[model samples]
Target: MGVTIRPQVGALPVRFDEDGILQVLLITSRRSRKWIIPKGNPMKRLAPHHAAAREAFEEAGAIGEIEGRSRGHYRHRKRKARRQFRCRVAVYVMTVERRVERFPERGERAVRWFTVDDARGAIRNRRLRELIARVAADLASSGRPAAGQPA
Candidate 1:
């Protein structure tokens, strides 16, 4: 029998800096040259939004408040030891508070911030690019403060 595969659900946390500049946290995978948003396997018994927040911390050393709601979905392919696979990821937006450059579980990875436009151009996947564009547009239209602002 062929191995069974299931699509995993994941989230991408995004934030913007002051002056309405869009900034997203990106992680450089040690093995893969792909620069991607921080995301990971779903947590057991944890909601997607909370899981997203946790992943941002673990992957990018980010602490942030979840803003708005989970936005949309995107698909990506993953390669295992000898198999190729595809998974769908649900994206979410969060307002970043702080970023710690160092973390205990930091893998062979480096984290950096990118402008939304740069990020859109950097990622290889077209689906991800579209997702980022849509999310950025939504945030802009919302007119909410980046992180700290008066109501």
Candidate 2:
């Protein structure tokens, strides 16, 4: 088995479309270009959700309100340089207010908004995809906006 790496934080940036349907924002990984949620290493001085929000801004240009509670966590192996390691990432939900044209990592990533089903299809991580599906179902059934905020 590969070495266990430090746990990371991630954000599921979401918003309601003009028609009030929920949409998710996904970004391409810097190297692989695979669709994924915005994520990064946790900052020791920042709370987990805050770190997740920061990653969203840097990776996806997403500015939003992040829920304090995590949606869930998933484990995956990551390849950095010439080594592979396992990492556990806790994901928070962010209700995105807007996206900026530029961010810290804007040049290195591709960002896009997708419908719940389309987002699920685009994501390669099975655990993350399932987590998003559950969250979308809950938000849809409750008739509430992302992060349980008022519509």
Compute each candidate's TM-score over C-alphas.
0.83, 0.93
lDDT of 2 by residue, 1-151 (tens): 6565679999999888989889999999978899999998999999999999999998888997888888798877789889887889998889998999989997898899999999999988899999999889877887754555522
Candidate with top TM-score is 2
Count clashes in each candidate, considering only residues at least 3 apart in sequence or on different chains. Answer: 0, 0
What is candidate 2's CA lDDT for residue 14?
88
lDDT tens digits by residue: candidate 1, 57-126 = 8777888776435577777777879888767777667677787877644866777778889988888879
Which ten contiguous residues of candidate 1 have the minimum total lDDT? 142-151
Each model's lDDT: 0.71, 0.88
Q: Which stretches of model 1 miss by more than 4 angstroms?
A: 1-5, 104-107, 145-151
Give candidate 2 misplaced runs (Cα > 4 Å). Answer: 1-5, 147-151
Query: What TM-score number comes out for model 2?
Result: 0.93
